[model samples]
Target chain A: MSTIFQDLVDTLRKSTLHFADTKKLMNTLNIIVTIKQVPDTAEVRIDPKTNSLMREGVPSIINPEDRNALEAALALREAHDGTVTALSMGPPQARDALEEALCMGADLAVLLSDRAFAGADTLITAFTLSRAIMKIAKYDLILCGRQAIDGDTAQVGPQIAGFLDLPQVTYAEGLELKKGGSLIVQRGLEDSNQWVQVKLPALITVTGRINHPRYPNLYNVADSCDDAKIKIWTAKDLQLPQAMLGLGASPTTVKKIFEPDRKMKGEMIPGDERQMAEALITKLKEMHVI
Target chain B: MIQLVPEKCIGCKLCVKACLFGGIAVDGKVPRLTDSCTGCGACVDVCRVEAIIASGEKTGPVCDFAAYKGIWVFAEQHAGKLHSVTLELLGKARELADARSAEVTAVLLGSGIAALDGELFRHGADRVLLTDAPFLANYRTAPYERIVARLICEHKPEVILIGATTTGRDLAPRLANRLRTGLTADCTGLEIGPEGGLLQTRPAFGGNIMATIATPNHRPQMATVRPGVMQARLFENKKGETVRIAVSEEPGDGLVQILKTLAREKSSVSLEKAEVIVSGGRGMGEPKNFKLLENLAGLLSGEVGASRAAVDLGWMPHDHQVGQTGKTVKPRIYIACGISGAVQHLAGMQSSDIIIAINRDPAAPIFQAATFGMVGDALKIIPELISQLNANT
Candidate 1:
């Protein structure tokens, strides 16, 4: 990991000359990036024993797109001489993700964890996160991953922006701070790319296409593990009301959770490779999909 | 918190079977809630003895249920053309409306796009709430959210359906929060519950599981369904009344300004639009081996796609990746070559009209999602396929 980080740093050092000298700017951005720790869903499996998701050994990692969001925040800070706060809401185990963020050059890391925060849906989660952001109090921009793989809702960022009543730009593939306190963001839409300019104090959710997240530096990784560098906050820290904190506050309840019904299974084609190829072609032709 | 009423406990262990998370276990005579319990209420419904309950679960209507009426679809339009998802949503809204005996309304927002209302009407909208303004011509978060939130505040539609497209995903959440209502995202299925609530069902955990959700206590229940998940039926000559919502010509707040919109380059195949997709994965061996997939895609007039493994290995571009971290594609025919289908990869393409898997291992999970499977070396079989195609065409 350190070798990759070193190589990327060397390449980035060479490319840094091409950018404008942002140090001349009158004011710099204070950015907050929201991240989540999720089970690497790629390797997640259903356990035959309990018929439940086999998460016993599934590795937890900073959500893929959240890394991109952190990279965006880090890049901005590097260019403009600002601070990047990596904030997260999850169980205590989520500190690993925040540590990774700090190792990747986040100036500060805050983990919001408490038993009262369990079982919150997207709305309540966003509400709780918004309250935490309020406690952080000074932020020119808020960045988040488009969605977490566990949920796949892509709702939290915009919902947070909603609770804060801030303008938001989602699916951001690229962003740059401009003169006059405006942010120029390039959004990757379904069929097109849109360029929008929003003022500071807005929220942006970045996609993985935005940038390659840098690996944590070897030295930074060691330092990031120091407990003093990480702050743990609970529901009381954010002054959240009991009625607004947990499962009870969440309006949407999960009525059921089950393995996806496999309505149709593929028929295995028989015979040798040549015959199999020929058979597939015949079926495609018959379906008029050739 | 999940609770068990000891007096009512029968300990049938049905709740244990119902819980997908293994949150409940029958200990001796009574079932006990474990720390893993998410309070999802799956156990509560399965308990025949009514012993389990998620205390503080909203059982009564939190808001006046009689005040809210009508089913509304946000008729998303871009450059004066209605997005097909809007029509699909209208079809869904029509079904939902019929279930509850409510009127279907399409909320159209654009400048000089009243002509699109006719299409909404033909697609099962009983009414069109037209909000035409210069500022509303293109989608910007602030103005659109403001207007839509205002309309919802005034009209109080019992349910609002929006396509989970780029704009809708961005708009709906903020609007839902502003209205202090629950909004389910990327719902693949929606139905009126016995209590007249919208039961929204969507895939979760990288599509390993399906979760049904409901906002039991919120008014104007909201949900966003992804495009292509719902079918749009045309009801030709269906008539509807248009109610004009006058908006100020001036831009509100001026927080965001649209600079430009660029259509994606035509050189790259649009994976979502492609009818056929030939995908490669880790088993393809090397980056150079992708040429086989490229050739196959060219012959089939399809696009080439890749699994996350191939992309992570630097064998393919990120845009070509199909998985939870990549694009979700539902082509008519998806050919998976040398791919061991992980749940994440399956989440993206399991909805394809037909899936053909080619792998050397018959036991590979990809076979489960395939419409037809062949256990063989993809590198050898692909060449055979190419040669055979040459002979035929």
Candidate 2:
């Protein structure tokens, strides 16, 4: 698997070289991939007694959508010969996700972890990420998942774009190198899709349709154990004021938490196949579904 | 209670435009707030220089009569048709309305929508507030906000409920900002306190937790409930009285109108109205695998949905994504495949009539909400389940 990946990388490098002097290939590329670690949703269980999710033993993994973002970055790096950096803000355990990105071919990894980063809503999260990106400086591209599985706000990407004052291409499915250091990309809208040409150093939030991410093979997995080196950054490293890192930075706050009211009790309409179908149909009709 | 620093202002006038209440005016090159400034902080978001700050005070006038009343639901309409979520909100509103003996009124706005007044009555509205005008024929944010804001100001309804649809989501925040009240968006539950305060509940922290909020000191506590979260009232064939109000002709131009709107095409999957929904998650592994969900949905005559995970993965379209950032669906039967029931994902579909969870992990949080649970691999079980469903069909 390692040989295949190396061969693929070589092929990509050669192809990119062939396109050299093609105005789009002239500039240096700096790519930032944003990621997160979330509990495997399929493994999470709600404790009946507590009426809350039972998260204790649930396995945590890199957010599935973020994996796509990483793959897109890796592919871009392989083609354009650019540096791909992985960045994440989470608890200490989230370092594991950064390590995975390194194994997937990222050149560098940075984890934004600190107690001061806790209880951040989307607005604060965007503020922190934008500040961090600004500190990183001279990045030609920014890649992010359309939304995180945990928060599902889908606001951070746009909000970050707003903060950075960069034109954003959201829900991108594909990209092509264009003339004059510009990229022609496809953006998926609600009713239909449209293509836009954006100058370099732009922010893009990707949807899942871009590419199939390659799995880590035995050799890469083994090498990852030795090669993985993550740079840990805190509020101080990013040079952000203490008040702007966490809950205090967030304008919106969650005032209380409660279980939603369940109006109808689940009733099992049981019987043989035909009987069950009839019962289901009858129930649907009674509920005005017909 | 939001304040702006004059020195830092770039004279962008974004705050002036964001102020729903016409309280802030641009004086030469600076934004000036009046005594009518409600302190809602709606203008704070438009400050590019971070000049506007929330003062954290209850700075608005206290409507004494509104303090004693209960919650109210505004039934929104478009093109003379009442939005389906209106009835759903009425059902939820009835509960809170009954708690405080507060009458549930459905505020209808549109030209010639008075004929549909009986529909709201049958669906549980005690009174219908009607405002008809040619300007309302199309949903322009300014006109709708004006009528709704005027009604709230006049009637002094303690609580206002609106469906979190495109129109509702757009109008609610503006109205709340104008009224100097707090608004909870995409709420799934609502409760009234003994003091007639509204406890608005919604999923937060990416759906990891549910948050209940209230405006303790504000009147006309506002909330926007997503469609399908609340059950629609059983319809009865009865008419209710309609009180008509005059529509204003003044057009407020705060923003640019660059493009004319064309006719919108109908969506392929109206999951919002589906009786059964079969949704997939990242567990499906790849975009190509979403075909299985589509096939299963076809057999069941249901709509296909995806968690924000799957949608973000690009396996499905954003329109099919169900969550806080995506569309909220309340089907009668929701079959979750490889969906871990993340708080964000569950917030969108938890109100379904029957939930069926299919995952390898028996401890999947979706199982807690599922009425029937099949603890096994979705890839393996879905094919078999699809076959069984097909045979029965």
Candidate 3:
């Protein structure tokens, strides 16, 4: 068992003993949270000629969905005693997001950063994260946001589960503790919902509806900045091959990025109520809309 | 000039299944590309076996015609009811077809949906291609793709348009993959080009920028439009005709089954479809504070919504979230509270009829887009607005 998992188990056992009713308390609870620092999506701009993102001056922050995932983990910690560890892979600045996680209530933070870990697509990203989790050794549950706001691929969680050879319950809305070391979770499917039970050490990706995250207090924020003990590991430190860490490991590459030209000026029809309706109808007819 | 390595082929046959041009064939255990391949790389993404490679070279049959021939719209229907977006697309298609002196054809597919044929023609389809099959009843991936691809192949329409719904998203990619054609998804605007091609425009980079794409080299340029973005043409008195096509007898795996569907109790209003929306943000403070937004929405006969910030804070459900990650809405009136108007949130509701911003921060970005701006606390402004509205009522 990994140290973090053992610590989580210990915390759960202690809580169970304190409660004095194993039947009432949930068993085998541990949370592994996946977080990422993406360029603030609101601040991103595109160069018209290149059609590529103008990333400069855009501040990076924890992805909103990832923050929700962290909050879900924290809520689980509060409801049923367990340890929450934050994990991320990016440049050195990514440590800030993990630190924010610690300040928010994460017991530990892990940074997977190195030059070789750059330019990773979702597949390579999930692979590296799964490998890092394997190295961490102990975790009863894994949690991530459904998708990153920037890419909007919604592929990482499922890909990571595929890499780790684990059954995944994605788009999780709610979680409940079951008696036999299993979790009953409500998953959101398109047009419907499903409830599934999975054993310990399962992976789940949470949507924004899962839980409301609490804001960090002044003391916790101060402690997060001052009492920093973030464990930083490179591909070498994790014993991962260099080829499997970065662009070399990634299967997909963006060949070109260009702005699509807008041929017609999207005109907004204007006038008073009757005139407006008439103009809209006339415009539609003129354009052969009818 | 996409390439497929025989050695790398795991024989998942996604490329074979996706090829609309019929340019690829499964030879025992590998996919073999032919001279008709257009190098669109639609198959590259779906090939889990990673056998298909995009060489990025243009080495297929170049379209010989300088002038486009026909205008097509990928007509979308659900539960025997055609989406208004499809009619809206027909409106746009009618414009393009008139400009190019081409014919407008709407492609309809589903089981026993012939009753909708007359309605489709009345909404501007010069001709309708109907395909009925039991397999296409519930919007399954494989059957819809097969029917749409077959129609496109047979009819050879110059341009094809589909609404960017869940069904359209799934079908377009697969059809594009099969046809070796270019497809642009989530287009907010579209125009017919001088060269008789399509100018497909959509927001990219997390809705930070708008991109207009064109498929100059491929026939039947494809694009998907969002619902409510385009204006649907009013019904006309002119008569039109429908042609029914035989459904193919190809067997589908049907690996995924719908065991049961439980309609979630419609709790709050659906923000995307609501005419009026009142959205709250982190500025509202605690989760309890969101009730003011709910009250305001109720008074306005609107739906309560939240920015990604409020949703992230767990103050509201994800369905009510208005941002890039959530639902895109175009309501008649959208009142934002305490929301700083993050670009993601703006992208979803920027097209609203009237925008009202209530924020303590004078420099909030929402002010730029708002028709009415009040520099005050949302907690204070909300109750006041509610009382004023009550007085009027």
Candidate 4:
């Protein structure tokens, strides 16, 4: 055969194989991603007089690490045929986060919002989310961000695993679905990396290093704004005991919030850039810091 | 439920300002609770006229606080070495235990690691609870959870402290849920309250603010403290008794399997161990600019650290990040180059003995924490400083 003809035949054969692989039912997975809408921490400030958080102008964004988790779930679904459900427990405004997840290609979005869930700590939040997860019971995997920026507790995902009686892996940066019903995950530990394998129906919490989240599709952005694709659930919708739903059910309570003392004021070097550098070096030597 | 007593309402609107959640509106002559009301009691505490009444909706079986006693530290170990945080926690436990006239018990788990009990005692443990088993050698969530939960049920510890390392973060929450108790994470301070409750103080909102939390109605009040946040002391010549608990055979292979572990390189010390750290952030502009930071760090015989923004921007690895989500460091010196010093970053390195901040923005928050502040471009300043130091040598 001619060289051009031979190349054409090979390309055609590769496309045929790709089509066959997609048609075959293998390694399908159902994934649920748990996300949170957190106020942009950089913009968070405290009201000096009231000594409370000044959240007036702070914009709420999808928790950064949770975006990585959603990206991991979307990538998994692309490789294997499955559905990705994005779930969150917060105020009604949390629907904005789920809608963004929908724009990112999540098959379904759920918002568990109610006044009763307002003062929930990590444990109550986990209980509320786990109740929703049980309601959407057809899943082989659950993914969550390692922690939310606002609370920084990092307890909800593991607590959800506890509530659902599922095995869990935390701080996952890499994931691979095996041919069988197991997943190999690389967990980012402090000062080390650990690879572990767990069967299906397990939960994994992902760190920000896992993958960069893709921008939401513009078309999906418009469609995602439609209220039909997003489902809202209150404390009553989950049918969980009110005792395990909110402030009263929480094991931990916040006694007070205050600003840490900032008493130290440094001496600012007064000079041009080059002059400041020279002065800094001299001071360092004087203090023996260098 | 948050209710306003209209008869006594002065309508000072102090409650409105105190409601962090924007739950109260003073639109009416008296404040009315909105759907946003979380009943956090912030408004109730501020209402000097006693106009607001906050009543929490009670639920669940009440805990019998009297039944629980003694303080427990989950003494974590890797390979054959005990984590330094374990000692720090034991020290804090010793302080709390001393206040209550209670004993401090260190729960040590690992195969053939009973030898660690001596160090635990020297660090302030009154007793050591050892569980040595082949299955317990590695920290798989299920087995460790089962063993630790079983021990807690049997011993009835009043307070439990775990290091907020990866392993502790994984294990503490599961145990909390299984026990149906409350747990606080990454606490900076732990103290016994006037009402005999464990007051756990931790940073929230990305370390922009601090909140004091309490497990008021739960037994075995648990909190995870990050390393270097607490001081570790030695009791020199102190001794404690060790009770070895037998482990039953696990029913089957665990749901998860450990494939491999890549231990950190010994030559590259962790940021927490570095005496000096020259750090960079978003203001470094690009990935290549981090080289200047590396050069400065090399000259100072120190390591290079990155703010979360630099790490997230792929300018540096996650291991180099210093912030609320990263390793807490208290180095002898911390040089923040072109870093704006987010509160999260300050939470990690502000405790350093000396801080030097170099940023173009005079308003950068890092300056507030710096012992020395230079308002200039880091790119221009670092090279000049490097040449100057080189000439000095």
Candidate number of the best DockQ: 4
| Shift of residue A132 alpha carbon in model 2, Å | 18
- Residue B190 of model 2: what lDDT? 83
What is the per-residue lDDT of model 2 for residues B1-393, given as tens digits with 9 covering 90 to 100? Answer: 667788888887866765655768777667788876766554654455656765554244354644446556777776677777898998887777787777778888778787887888888777888888766775645567767877787678877888876556546655664554556677777887555567777775556667777667667777777776788876567566788888776734222121223343667878887877889998888887788888878877899999887986678877788877777877878988899777677778877777877776655667767766666667766676566666655
TM-score, cand. 1: 0.83
A78 Cα displacement, candidate 3 (Å): 23
What lDDT does model 1 reach?
A: 0.83
* Cα lDDT of model 1 by residue, B1-393, tens digit: 567897788767766754544668987776777876656554654354547755664332236789899999999999999998999999999999999999999999999898888899999999999998887889888778878877886788999999888999989998877666788888878999999999998888887788899888777789998777787889988999999998874444478888999998754757878988999999999999999998988988899999988998899988898875577788898999999887667878888999999999877778888999999999999999999988899
Each model: TM-score of chain B? Answer: 0.79, 0.81, 0.84, 0.82
Model 1 residue B367 lDDT? Answer: 88
**How high is the lDDT of residue A237 in model 3?**
75
Q: RMSD to native for every prediction?
A: 12.3, 9.2, 10.7, 13.4
Worst 10 residues of 4 chain A by lDDT: A16-25
Every candidate's lDDT: 0.83, 0.69, 0.69, 0.83
Error of 2 at B122 (Å): 2.4
**Residue B198 lDDT in candidate 1:** 91
Kindly report which residue pairs in candidate 1 clash with one another. Answer: none
Task: Order the candidates by lDDT, highest first.
Answer: 4, 1, 3, 2
* Model 3 CAPRI quality: incorrect
